[model samples]
Target: MITTVQRPTPADWDSWYTAGWPAVVTDKESESFHRTVQPYPGMTAVDLACGNGQWMRQLTAWGVFVTGYDFSTEALRQARAAGLPDGLSYAQWDIDAEPIPPALMPGSLDLVTCRHALPYLEYARVLTDVGRWLKPSGIFYALVRVADDQDNATAQSDSVLESFHRGFTEAQIDGIGIGWARRTTYRLSARNCGIVLRGYGDSDCQPCDVSS
Candidate 1:
């Protein structure tokens, strides 16, 4: 049985991107997230932990000014090599160790997207900070990998490898819901173990109650 596998460190992530991650989401799945945001011209968005700039490319294509941030240098290198268009830029940051960069001003972002990347760090804290950075009408769109009771252990075999921690629970998702003006969730397929969460931020909502 698989047991006692260590969580991925920054260096592990660097190598993961170097070797490449085989992203398995469908076009419909990606379109679902895009449809939820409906990002328009002149909108500013940040894609936290953007691995290889997929979302950034989509958002920029929709005329959104987008910044893709990732801690892994190799990931950023790969993203930059993709020939990012105008209205798109990238920054290297260790989200768990630092505050959101000052350039990404509070209440100035139209959207913030984190796709399949939150489980590698302190997601709760990251979500709270993301809530604070958004504009009143902004949306926090995340495709998160939720934890399950199955075996996700890493081994030295030729099987498919998973990089993140176990996953998040329902309570954690609900805790995120409490802070938004409105929140909607769509569960992905069994292969992903993910949920597409879109949280709208407006003036009337309370701060995220993460204490639970």
Candidate 2:
């Protein structure tokens, strides 16, 4: 059965093993991912399913106007309590709901990062949505749970990719690799996690850049 996406409050979510944040297994090894999405001074980026706004906080520091969205009120409250910079903002939205308008900010946002959260939804549809939300030349950075060389049996059981696709499709895509290579980027595990696929999307069909 497909589980419905929910935005639980910190109060209610705390009753579980972990509270209201968009985190995967509370593994000590899962490092905090910082999307190195180079944008202009006034670029806008959205952190979808932002757990505790860790990267959200960093993005704002990098001069990108960051907007974080999650269903967890506790997470949102914590983000607010953290006293973010002037350009930082937060909103609540259920991930299971399809085509949510308010959450989809259209062409205004320059980048959208959905780290450690893609396995929970329909990958194709979610990709389509990200494509819709981005500006003509925007970026979508994601970290999906996959069977990349970093898997233990226990970890695999809880993988979001396992929860969705029976198997996974691993690709190193970039702007030049896809139909619209000059306008897209696909950097798989370029930064932190060894298995994570990092994508830098432009207004293209999603490919990779070989020169970089």
lDDT (C-alpha, whole model) for all candidates = 0.68, 0.53
Which pairs clash in model 1?
A: 147-167, 147-168
What TM-score, over all chains together, does every model reach? 0.80, 0.62
Model 1: residue 6 alpha-carbon error in angstroms: 6.5
RMSD of each: 5.5, 6.8
For candidate 1, what is the TM-score? 0.80
Best by TM-score: 1
Candidate 2 residues 15-127, lDDT tens each? Answer: 32143323432222222323334455688888887866776776776688988887767667777887878899988876667447575666766788776656455555566
Worst 10 residues of 1 by lDDT: 151-160
Model 1, range 1-212, lDDT digits (tens) per residue?
Answer: 11333456668778877777636447766666666556788998898988878768877877999998988888888889988799999999888777768887777787888877665567666767777787766777777656544433332223435544345555555555654566656666553433333344445764443210
